[model samples]
Target: MPHRPNTPCRHPGCANLVPYGQQYCETHKLLHPEALRSAGSRGYGSRWQRESKAYLRAHPLCAECARQGKYTKATVVDHIKPHRGDPALFWDRANWQPLCKPCHDKKTWNEDKNPVYSY
Candidate 1:
């Protein structure tokens, strides 16, 4: 049997060669098991992914950045109001807004830490 051509592991700083079909090497994959989870298991499904893509396509700019007069591109579709696991609000288009990853993460972190926090 002949050795297959080696491809670099996708993880940054990793030098390990992975089989063609795999993304991350075994070490990284084991360290980040969530990467192996399905989209639905990660709080998103095909429907949400589709909706998010459409919203981003239409919006293009991050809402928060726009509010500050900056025009950064949005990469996340955020819920204006937390759905709190409610299917109705969770799927509500009116509650959705496109946000850059940084803005979204900061907003989400603040909201998670305090419901009525400011500044």
Candidate 2:
């Protein structure tokens, strides 16, 4: 008769043993599938959205509209280029633009779908 070797769970503070290649214990392994995805991925949800909002508030003036001496209260942050195929651009401040609500929505419809509303 052959015996299988015991493997410890990978979860922090967990002492229970699990099968090889299993990181967490059975109880902890029931994590949501969405939770397994990287935050950098699109449609990963609100965490990334919140971070973008904070960035926008930090720079609450429209960069484009401001350049023309127009003071548009920035309630949204937009990506100059689309972030669909390039998720890395999401956090690039160089690609960010502040715009008022109406202008932001208009740009969102006319431009890329990567505009993150912060209002």
Best by lDDT: 1
For candidate 2, write residues 52-116 as lDDT tens digits. Answer: 68878798888768878998778777777756546578667788777878777777666422333
User: Can you write out model 1's per-residue Cα lDDT over 34-100, one digit (the tens) per residue?
Assistant: 4587758756888888888998999999999999999999999999998655689988889999999
lDDT of 2 at 52: 67
TM-scores for the candidates: 0.62, 0.50
Over 4 Å off, model 1:
1-43, 115-119
**Which ten-residue region of model 2 has the weakest summed lDDT?**
110-119
Backbone clashes in model 1, listed as residue pairs = none
For candidate 2, give the lDDT of residue 106: 77
TM-score of 1: 0.62
